[model samples]
Structure formats: structure tokens, C-alpha cells
Target chain A: MKKIIALLLAAAMMVVAAGCGGEQSASSGSGSGSGGKQITMGFSQIGAESEWRTANTESIKQAAKDAGINLQFSDAQQKQENQIKAIRSFIAQGVDIIAFVPIVETGWDTVLKEAKDAKIPVIVVDRDVKVSDDSLYVAKIGTDSVKEGNNVFKWIDEYMAKEKKTPRDGGSQYNVVVLEGTVGSSVAIRRQEGFKDAMAKSANAGKYNLLASQTGEFTRQKGQEVMESFLKSYGPKIDILFAHNDDMALGAIQAIEKAGLKPGKDITIISIDGVKGMFQAMIDGKANCTVECNPLQGPLLMETAKKILAGEKVEKLVYVDEGVFPADVAAKTLPERKY
Target chain B: MDMLKKFAGSSLFLPVVALLVLLVFNTIFVDGFLSIQLTEDGRLYGRLVDILNRSCSLIILALGMTFVIATSGIDISVGAVVAISAAVVCTMIGGRGDGVAQMPMALAVLAAIGVGVLCGMWNGLLVAKFKIQAVVATLILMTAGRGVAQLMTEGQIITVYYKPFEYIAGFLPGMPLPTNIFIALAMVLLVAVLMKKTSIGLFVQSVGINATAARYAGINVTLVIFLVYAFSGLCAGVSGLIESSLIRAADANNAGLNMEMDAILAVALGGTLLSGGKFYIGGSVIGAITIQTLTTTMYALGVSADQLPVVKAIAVVIICLIQSKKAQEMFDAWKARRMSKQNGKKTSVDGKVAEQA
Candidate 1:
């Protein structure tokens, strides 16, 4: 019994030593003492499960470095509970600022209130959280999903007019099939309504038909599967394919090609989210248009954090300026696309 | 009365009744739910067809799950195995623009399934040889499998544009149903025949009931367990093919998310006990369709996607209660009380008259 107790004591000491060893290296890498009284910020990231998210993480890290802020990072790996736990840890550590991209929109009330009580400002990025108190987060930085949706349809109208196939001019009738984002997600619902509302306002609203729209869940594979079903069900009548994100559009390109149709020529594809892959697709002439949702909100996020620290009242909701990039313009913008 | 008692006594009874109830509910609440129309292209259309079509992947998984659970072992890695299989096949196809296969489809498919078989063998090795708990052993792959899939696809969704590949999941020329349906049926039949015709099924039951006893009885218990896990892996492989083919791409992140739970639930809903022993593959197949029907019914009821899970959970709990032994006991007690009450009054009146005389 004496020997066993001694061994356990040794094990506990070893764990403590190992933990200190890890912290020393991490702090040195982030360069803590080079700046004067460096502002420590704890960021809880929703894991890099996709290319867009990876870019988002990189952008945030790069921005923190440029500003010389001590950034504490945690990855939630797509779970709300983990994000909440990370937020609690930030509170315990007494960081100057807490920032996160929420995995979901609900169940954040208690955590936000706790952060508020701790007197540390929380900044939300990429996604929104539902808290009854508006001051839970100093500022929300995200894309206007509905606006992005509207931009894509507007681009489609321009593309049609350039092709001398304007339905408004009584040129031809067209059918559209929509590939939506994750079902019941804010982005999916808003994007679906945005484009539909745009089309309804078009001069040839009655001439153009909304064939079918199904949730692709904003993933490439489901995008392809849903597109395959659309092809089988609607067949040659589908002229316009509007996807909520570029991932789905890229997936649908495969299905359209498999069906022996030239995606850009035979079926015009319009998508949102200006990921680099979409730029490549645009250059390849497989994708027709992409409205940028710009995943690189890190610099702006930090900027807002600084302003809040300086005691300036920042906008409660900060809308990132975005653009619609057509296939013709993709070549020029391909070299400059941030995400 | 004897027939009714026998029918109720069978393990298949509850699952069949659950399916019937769902069907009746859909037919009543969902308009044109029972209608099956033939499309101009010789394909079947309607919600019923859709249910069967969608349930194909789940059916394949549950079929394998049925065997694993029968051995008192659980394999949660089947879903991960699916992602790996999809990754291998799609990357092997190496389709570029429009997903045209650069390589031969047969070789790609065989290699994918081969990987699946190997994964199963690994699970078998851990469970049967290393003596690790099945759940713990399979959990290793369940967490790591997606990562492996991501590695194969280079963190991208690998799309296959190969036309012949579509025949695996999509409808064939002049066929009214998807080819996957036929594949699922064939797998069920093959497994059913193999289990019933040979002594393997009995051997599995013995091992599950008591491994030491089965060993004393001269049964190769280790081999039986290994073979069942290996078979489960193969089922997952075939399921992966159908799933990836359905989408014509392999999505590492979302390929078969939460599918293991669905497969396990199907097995339980089919009336298989979690503790192991006698199993029914047909009941599991029907259970898979029942799950699909529930989803379709929810959609028909205009339940929002976020709220659908809550509704499904409540319904599942109710169905589970109905299937429980406790519920059966309570029901039997009620019946006995009513019968005894009717006879007691008559006997008491007759005794009074006799006494008076």
C-alpha cells in the first residue's frame, strides 16, 4: 500500500510537470513578452470540418498575429456543448475578449449571461446566437444570407440577357431547381426565400417556373445526390440550378455532366459562397456565377474587438460587404480571392 | 384462439404490427400515400416507392446489425466503414470534370468492398482474438474512419461522373425500382438461407447464450464471432456503394452520419433483444422501412426539420413501450381481471339458488 501510494504521487507530479511544459512552449510560440501588456483574447472555433471553415480559422489566426493580440483558441468540432464549455473556460481565464462562431442558433442564453456577469465582452462571428439580452455580444459579424441569395439571381438575370434568352422579353420559358443548405438553418431558410423573392419580382415571373427545391444540407455529396434526383424527376426541363453554397453547385456539376449535359451551357448554375474551388469551377466554365459570402471575417472581427475595448460603441450587427462574381469575371478575381 | 396466441408469441409480431400501424396512419393522414404510379420512363413513383427506395441503405446496415446483435456484440463502426468504402471507390474512379471515371468501374468497386472486408476482419480480430469489448473496439474506427475518408478524398467531396456507376443506386433501364432494392433483397435472402440451412445460426445462438458452454459443446465460438463481424463489415461496404452511388460522390463529413444508431434502432424495433440470442433478419428489414415511413409521415405532417426529431423520439418511445414485456404483462392482467369478473357473478348467483333449494 505504501509503494502504490508513492507511485500515484509520482504520476500526479509527472502530469503537472507535463502540463507546465506544454504551456511554456505554447506561450513562446505565440510570442507573449515581445509586446507591451498584450491583450489576451480567447476564441472558440467551430472545427475545421470543411474547406470554408479551415479558411475561416486561418484568417482569424492571421488577423490576430497582425494585430499582435494574444489569441487563445479552442475548437468545438461542431458541437454546441463544447462551444459553451470553451466560453466558460474563457470566463475562468478572465480573458479581455471572448469570440466564437456558434455551431447552432439556440441554447446560448445561460452561457452568454455568465460571460456578461464576468464583465468580459463576447463577439460573435460567422453565425448568430439567440440570447434574450442584446448586449450578450458586443457585435455580430456575418454575411447577409438573403442579400447573397438576391445577388445570385440578379446575376442570373444578367447572364440570361447577355445570352439573348431573357424570359422577360418573351424570349424563352425556363425552369429552376434549387439545392438548399442545411434544413431549418438560418442560412438555408433565408437563402431559399431570398432567391424566390427575387424571381417573383422579376418581369418574367410567371414565365419562369420554380420546378422543385430540396434541402441539400449544404454539403457536396448531398448536393450531388439531390441533383441526381432532380435530373431523374425533372429531366431536360431544368434550365437553372441555384444552390445555397458553392459546394452543392460543384457537386451538381458532376451530376449534370454525368447526364451528358454541359453544365454552364445546357444548365446555368448559380451558387453562393466564393470558395476557391468555385473560382476554379468558374474558370473551367462548369459553374456560371457565385455570390461571395466571404469567410474571411477575422480582420473585421478583431477590428470590432479593438473598437469595443477603446470604449467606442460598435454596431450591434456588422454586415460584411460582398460581391457577385460571374464566370467571365472569375479569371481576374481567381488570383485575388481570399477564401 | 390458439392461432392468435401463437401469432402474438412470435418475435416478428410487434414489428409487423408497428409497420402496419404506420402504414395505416400515413394512408389516412397523407394524401395519395397509398397510390403508386408508373412514370413515363418505367419508374415507380409515390411516397410508398420513395420509402422503399430510401430504406435500401438502412436495410442493408440493419441486416448486418441483426447478426452482430445476435452474437451479443455491437459494431458501431459500420457507418465509418461506409465512409471509407465510399472514399476508396470515388477516389479510385478519379473522376475530374463532370465526374467521368478515369479508371475502370469494376476495379474501383471491388477495391472499395475489399477495404470494407478488411475493416470487418480488423473488428473481428479485436473482438474475438484480443477480447476487447465490441463497442469499445468498434468506437476506435467510428471516430477515426471519417478522418481516414477525409485523407483519401483530400478533404474534398469526391464526385463520380461515371454513368455505369449510377446503375448501382439508380433505376436500370425498363426496371420500375432502383437496383439497390434488388441488391438489398438478394443480401437478405442470402443471409436468411445461410443462417437457416446450416448449423451456423444455432452455433451463433449458443455462443451468445453462453460462450463457455458453447466452447464446451465443441462449437468454434471464436470463429463464429469473427465471421459475424466480418459479414457485418461486408454489409456496410455494400451500403457505402449504394450511398455514394446515390449521390455520385463521397462526402467524408456527412456520408453516413448517425447511420449506426439508425441501424441499431432498426434491429431493436425489429424485436431483437440487446442481450443477444434468437434473431430475425426479415423483422429488421421491415423495421428499416417503418423508420423511413415515420420520416415521410413527419414530412407529410409539415413538421419542421428542427422539430421532427422531438416528434420522432416521442413516437419511438411509445412504440418501444408497446413492444415491452412489461406492457404485455399488464395487458394480460387486464384480460384476466375482466374474465374473472364475468364468471364470479354467475357462480355466486347459482350458489345462492342452490342454498335456497
Candidate 2:
């Protein structure tokens, strides 16, 4: 009878230990957890799609380290289903805050609502989600993707304006082509729309036409293939190649060399996502312009979290600042340009 | 006439018919998609060539898989074997140009084949020696193989330095054909010759038909299972080399992703029964060709990114349905009558069946 009682006590002790472990991890991000554990944070990345994505991932890791944040990382691998699954796992884990770079802008409302109901603050970074209710996300910390596109087209138009070059003097003087990103993606839709709007609004550069717009799916191989087709069809007529992202732009540079053409002079190029490669491209005079898409989320997110915690009003839409890099300026600033 | 009817009654007839339907549909809908074309190089250009070059890998895989499945076994590890062999070749060359290219292409290919064989042997040992389920054994290797490729290349595209290596992906001058297509075709022919033309092929079919019966008859079941997997591994190596050369680099991230799935799909589409007994090498090649041609056509038509995966899924499912036994039974009945009428018109002085044909 004594042995049975002892076994029961042991089993009860194990259950208590397991419960405490579950509770500790769950409440770690609360900032009120015992023994001063830095706020626990869960991050969901939208898969490694390219070199830029890989760099974005590394930057996040570094940010987590500098801020002393317990980062629970998950790679959705470009699958919306996986992203949803990871967020649910984060909620169940009871982390203090939840953050994710959305795979697409939709299908996040239900999960975001679940996180909100749990009293866990959800922060969106890099990309924004399209939810009917704005309260589902605490604050979206991302760059102005529309302006990023407008800036690329605007820079090209401005350069042509400064050169005093007009296509009316020659036939098909600067036939520009565009490589779109993923279909139905917030970045792809907004960038394409913004670029078109800006280009159309320009009375002087309206002569510069977009000959082709095809989806590269934001992959290097597809970018190379699409660029190859454009070159073959356009021949000497093609002038500028505007890609939605830097990785595709880099791939087009390789294709240009593969096809026996000069990159910067023969085919002027511009892209978004001021990644290390884009900077390198700018420094080497292979690419013309790039709009930065900052991956650093700590300062903005931490400040917002503090405000929310302090019961002070916070900004609903927090837009990260974007800057452009020209060939001359990029060479000087290459060393200091952090992603 | 009766003999012809019996032949048509075979399970492969429906798959062949479904392939025709897809061809017709693509011809109608897809722009610039007609397979019949002549290039400046005096060779065929279009869907046929696309299929020939790409289907070679899947054909070799399916031929080997047919043997394994006959023993009521499954392998989900062929993709891993391809990755390992490709990685091995890329590492051997180490992306050195103007120097490493001096080495004989045959030696490098043989070494790649050796690496694949080693991987296959490991899989065989795990399943046969340890008494593990075929799926479980292959699954273990499948998960590890990707990591092995990543470790080999240090997670970078390791480019190779070989001129002849590029030829395996396409063809040399005067051939006007992709080397991979021929390799695949030759392998399929070899498998068909072995199984239909040789006793060992018959033995494999018999063993798959009924393992207990084959064992009772004193056939070596274990040896047959081991050999099939090993051969499948060899096919995978050849495929990896050819495919890697096409890209000019070994990208471990997407090199062999979901390839084993495609091979299985092709094998099933080619009218090869998964329950294991009989094999269909020619039909399997056709199935692989059908898949490649479909992808090429979709790309040519400028199909959007989101729509590509859905299109592929629909095509595979529809082909599988057409290859089903019920569809085959229906096709055989239709084909037999058509054959008889054609024969009647050919032999008879009257030529009445010409109108019907």
C-alpha cells in the first residue's frame, strides 16, 4: 500500500513538471514572466525563395541576437498552408508576440483573429496581410512597396529627362520590359500597378513603352528564361529591363552576358529589394537602380510593443523608409548598406 | 483477328488513347504548340523533342520501379539517389574549368554511376536485411539525401567543367536529338527486351504476380528485389547527370524535388500496375513524354505561375483515370472492333472498311 502511494506521488510530480514547462515557454513573451526572461517572440518567414530571401533570413537572426529576443522561427517554404500551421503552433506554444512575413496578403484573417483572441500581439513585417479588420494585426512594419515601384520607373524617367533623350528621334529607342513576381502576391500586384501608374503619369517618358510583362515567379531560372525570350524577340531594340526583385535582376545580368551583350550600357536594369547582391550589382555597374526593402524589424516592432503595453495610442500603419541606390552612390555606400 | 483482339484487350490500350486526347486538346488550345516542326539544324523541333530529352530519366526510373513493384515493394528514394549522384559529379569536377575538362567524360560518368550504386545498395540493405517496409526504408534515405547534397555543395550551385557533359542533356551536331531522350528510349527498350524477350524478365513478372508461388517454385525472390532497386538506382544516376548538365550546375534545393512522385505517376499512367506483376516499359516512356510535353506546352502558352501546378495535377489525375482498368477494358473493346474492320477492308477485294476507317 505504501509503494502504490509513492508511485502515485511520482506520477503526480511528473505531470506538474510538464505543466510548468509548457507554462514557461507559453508565458515567456509576456514580459511579466518570472526571473526576467526577455520577451519571447515567434517569427514566421515566407520561405527562402532567392538569394535576397536568404539574406533577409540572416538579418532577422542577427536582429533577434542584438535585441536578446527569444525568436521561434518557422519557414513556410512559400506555402500559405504551412504559414497558417506555424502560426497556430506559435499560439499553442504561448509565446508573448507573434510576427510573420505573409506568403500572400489573404487567408490570414482567421489565424490573426485567433492570435488576437489569445491576447498575443501580432506584428507583420516585410509584407502586409489583407484583413478586413485592422485590429487583427497590432501594426504592419514594412516598406512602401508601391513607392518602391514608382521610384524604379521614376528614376529611369528622371535619368532620361536629365540626359535630354527622347525616343521620338529614333524607332523603338528604349523598349523596356518588366519581369513580374508571384501571381496574386501583394508585392507583385502593387509594384506592377504603381510602376504603370507612374509611367503613365509622366508626359515626357510616356514614349518609353513596356513591351512585355511576364511572371518570373520570383525565381532566377524563370527570370533568365523570360529575359532570353525578350532579348530574342526584341533583338537590338530592347533597352531597359525592369525586374520586380533583385534576384531576378541579377539572373537577367547573367543572361545578358550569356547572350553576348553589355549589361549596364546595353540594357539598363532596376529592381526592388536592396539586398547584398543588388548592392554588389550597383557597385559593379551591372545594374542601374534598386529600391531598398528593409528587413530589420526590431526597433519599429519593439517600440510599438512598448506603446501597446503602456496603454498609449500606436500608429496603425507603420511604413519603413525606402532609399534608392544609383551606380555612383552605391559604390561608396556598399560597405555601410545593411539589409 | 482474335489474336489482335486479345492484344488490344491488354491494360495499356486506354493510356495510349488518353495520351492522344491530350495531344489533340493541346494542339487546339495551346498556341505554337504543334509538335511537328523542323529546325534550322535539320532536326525535329517542338513537343516531340522536349518529351524525348526529358522523358529519358523518368523512363529509366519507371523501368526499374516496375521490377521492384512486382515484388509488392515501393521505393520513394530514387529522387535522393539522383541528387547524390549529381552532387558527386559536381564535386568531382569542383567547378574547375580549362583544367578538369581534360579528364575523360566516360570516367566521370562511371564514377557518378558508382556513387548512385552505393546509395542504392544502402537502401537495399536497409529494406532487405533489416526487414523494414519498402516505403519506410526509402523514406529514411529520401529525407537524408537532400541534406547530403546540401553538405556536398556547401549549399551552392556547384558548376561542372565538361563539354561532352552538356551533350547528354541535348544532342551533338548531326544527331539532331537530345541524348537524354535516346538514353531513356534505349533503357526502356532494354527493359522491354529483358522482361518480354528474356527469362529473367519473365521471372520478375512471375515473382511479382505471386511471390509465394515463385518462392514455392524455388526462385530467388530476395535477389530479384535487390537487383530491381539497384537498377533503379543506376537509372536515377544517369538521369541526375543528364539533368544537372542541362542546368550547368547542381542546385540541391530544387534538383530532384518531387521527381520520384513524377516517375511513380508516369509508371502508373503507362499502365504499369502498382500491385506488381507485369511491367510496361514502352508505356512508361510514353507516360513520361506525355508529362514533359504537357509542361513544355504550358510554358510555351505563357501559362501563369499559379495555374501551372493546378494544370499538372489535373492532367495527371485525368491520365490516371484513363489508365484505370475500367477505362482499359472499355478501350480494348473499342479498339478490337476497329482493328477487325480495318483488317477486313485490307484483305477483302471490296475496300468497304476504308470509309469506316
In the range A189-274, model 2's lDDT, one tens digit per residue, is: 99988898888887755468777777776755456656755654454677788999876787677667545577877788888887
Best by lDDT: 1
TM-score of 1: 0.70
- DockQ category of candidate 1: incorrect
Supply candidate 1's per-residue lDDT for A110.
Answer: 96
In model 2, chain B matches the true chain B with a TM-score of: 0.85
Model 2 earns a TM-score of: 0.67
For residue B32, model 1's alpha carbon misses the true position, in angstroms, by: 2.6
RMSD of each: 10.3, 9.4
Candidate 2, B93-199: lDDT as tens digits:
66654436645667778888888877777777776667688999889889999889888877666656455676777557667676777777677667767666668
**Residue B211 in model 1: lDDT:** 89
